[model samples]
Target: MKSTLKKLLPFAVVGVMSGATTVGALQYFNHDSNNTDQSYFTKASNVSFAGMNSAAVGDDFVKAAKTTVPAVVTIKNYQSRTSSRASEQDMLDFFFGDPFGGKGQQRQRQQQTPDNMPSGMGSGVIISPDGYIISNNHVVAGANKLEVVLSNKKSYIATLIGTDPNTDISLLKIEEKGLPYLNFANSDNIEVGQWVLAVGNPLGLNSTVTAGIVSAKGRGIGILGSQGKAANPIESFIQTDAAINPGNSGGALVNTNGDLIGINSAIQSTTGYYQGYGFAVPANLARKIVEDIKNFGIVQRGFLGVTSLDLSDDQLVAAYNKQKNTNIKAGSGIYVTGFGESSGAEDAGLKLGDVITKIDNIAITDFADLSMAVGSKRPGDKVQVTYSRNGKDATTTVTLRDQKGGTATRTKADLSVTEKIGAEFQSIDDKTKAYYGVNSGAVAKNVMEGSEMAKAGIVDGYIITEINGKPVNSQKDVENLLNKFSGTVQIKYLDDYGRGYQRGFKMP
Candidate 1:
């Protein structure tokens, strides 16, 4: 009976093992057949695999960074100031109080006055192998002492060759020759999502590089100079998601090929630190400024003499509806709100409310395109501008003029207001006349406090037709005539209603 029971147990165990094997085989076959329906994924496990395939596809960025970084530089600046006596109220409080330090000690402290010491730090890009560097004007502006440090750890005292605060571009020169430098690329060709690298000295950290992509282009952040001030203030900027901090200003924004694409200038952040959005001066504009600095010692921006606003999608639609009878459509061009007298636009016969559609055959789809086209030229260069008026497309050849509405060369060291009459002015074109319902001459836009005009009771928007009894045809004419006068001068003009008036003042 024991032998029979043992044989039965062995058979029972074998039967159980066979049944488990059969079930496992059936499940494996069923899973494999289900996965076969999706060729891309042989198994459900394949769906969870994570990796990037594009990283293996590009060599452009690595090669570009190698070329661009050497041309980038670190900039340091120093300024000096003197402190003066405080107001009478403050002096009385110091002499009367000071229960914490005693009267004698307070008296001694008052005798030893304290003033602020100037200090600044920024970044720059070497544009020429002969030691020409470009940076933001604010970096070196009002700096009594300028110093430049190279990638090789070599430092040199830099000379302020020129600066244009309107465009916020400054040029510097070092005595050295044959330095490593970068060449500017066509910023108009930069595309969204393209890889870019920002190299600079951030937070005073020497030679730092951060990666990002072009988030946008042709951004106007409402930070431009006024008329008779720097003519080309508030330039269109290249916006990026690069991690730019305070000290990154004036750094290089280079493409993967190591070519200069833009100059990192400002960032949009609430905490005064990196918030993912950084602004850059397009290389196209920077190149123009650099060239002007090298040639004329100043940035001679071509003046259009028009106030413009970017058209939103809805506004474009409305414009298209208004121009339905013509080939022009809304959202397809820039609208001119006002025109300045003797401006390039005025000379070109461009009217207020005209929509600029193209320049030199290049389609102007937005303000960025227009800015890029205009920024590419000097003050005297002529270009064809196309616009739509009353549904008809027309072309006009406009000779670009300086901010003064005349053909004049500029230098980097030239301050628009300080170099001239220390005041701002705008032309009184037909459009301006129509807007104000009357105009006879150019109007004063702004008078700097303590300037020659300010001391003379000259108010902003005051019309001026003559200076020192000489006909002032344009702002340039005013500037030229004022330069001829040293102490006192006479200004003549008509008010908004064409009423003649005259005034006399002393010049600094």
Candidate 2:
């Protein structure tokens, strides 16, 4: 039976190579062989042996490439600028040889116009079937014109929908429908050594695919500054050995199943090209950014407003031993330096010098993980934060809020104060005056910031019937009366928005 199976193995290989029914042949060979030791099957024909090995690798590459390439797109941007001290006609005539003759036109005028407008090329991935594309903010930043070229060579003009430079993500809209897109994979589940593909238009060459394994996770390159440009820059990058080059900045870094796990953002190289080290913004971070921009005009970032540093191995060991009188476990974690007075961290009872161990059930190995987790949440969202203080582990829930004391909700009446220099004047009417219970006068509901009334200790919600012993009912009348005393305007009005009392200040 083993000899008969060995004889049929060559036929099975040939069947597979020739696009024949190889499954049946392989099944028959395995069943007939029935022998535990299968070394005899290697003695098949050399052509069959070569075919099997090559077919396996070729099939995998073909399948992965076919699935990912269509979702990759080439992005081109054109910036427009206006020249200083020159009419459009003059610039056009200078470049195209002036048809209308003018004096001193042939003097070989020096073109002072600098090339402020630059063209750039990058890559993008289709995230939605209805033409929503995702790319890097730097790729489409300040672009007056954008063009997207698909794998099929079809090009379409793209409009910038929104961008969040803090997360290095931007959304673009195209007119076409039924476009191919890549589904986002759960980046939290991705682990080191997992196979992944990097698809992009590297060096302006469209639709290039490269394969590699994930090298590391939660990498911080400090590309995003402290304020985290635009908002808080989430810097939890998935490091991979994939060859991501310059034009790949906005491309897709997909997993084995052709699902987008990250957005290829940058490569660490001295020559400005791939050198076996590439970085991608995780897909989870990118998704949150895209959603925030689509909903809000700006990314609503929650700020803990605290400075922190990652604990060094030596420091961690020393701290543990000093507290517990034992050796420390080897693990990465962050130490809190201090908390800001007006910060959410302070309000949430987080004190100085606490070692943060985890956030939202995810391990906070370093500042990168903490930043990524915090950046992914919106203002007003609550998160569970775990930390250690004096060798004791503890957890707490903190509600995140914006840095500006939450959203500003103010009305015309709220602005009535000497500190606020804006005024609101109402039209002259009995019902309006009666609404405020004022006698024979309309309420002043508005004030200009630098107006004479503002300088005279008067603000919004001030009621005015007479100015400088002259009757005044409208804003124009006040302006006319104030025009008389440019040097030192004296204002007389009731503080309607504030306490109902007359007050005056000398305008300078």
Best by TM-score: 1
For residues 1-508, write the lDDT of model 2, one tens digit per residue: 9997877776567546533432343344434332111111111121111112222233565577888899889887665433332333333442343455753233323333233323677889999989999998777764657888899999898988867666778899899889999988999999997778899876545787876788899997766553223335678899987766667888999887788999987766543444457889999988887776576544667766677766645675677568757554545777666775567776877887678888888998877888888878877788888989888998888777665646232332332232132354665687766665545444555343233354344555566755555655776665566543534333445554423332244532
Q: Rate the local accuracy (lDDT) of all candidates.
A: 0.68, 0.66
Candidate 1 ranges beyond 4 A from true positions: 1-62, 84-118, 225-231, 307-309, 313-332, 408-508
Q: State the displacement of the C-alpha of residue 99, model 1, in Å, after optimal TM-score superposition.
A: 30
Each prediction's TM-score versus the true structure: 0.63, 0.61
| lDDT score, candidate 1 | 0.68
Deviation in Å, model 2, residue 376 alpha carbon: 0.6
Clashing residue pairs in all predictions, respectively, total: 12, 7
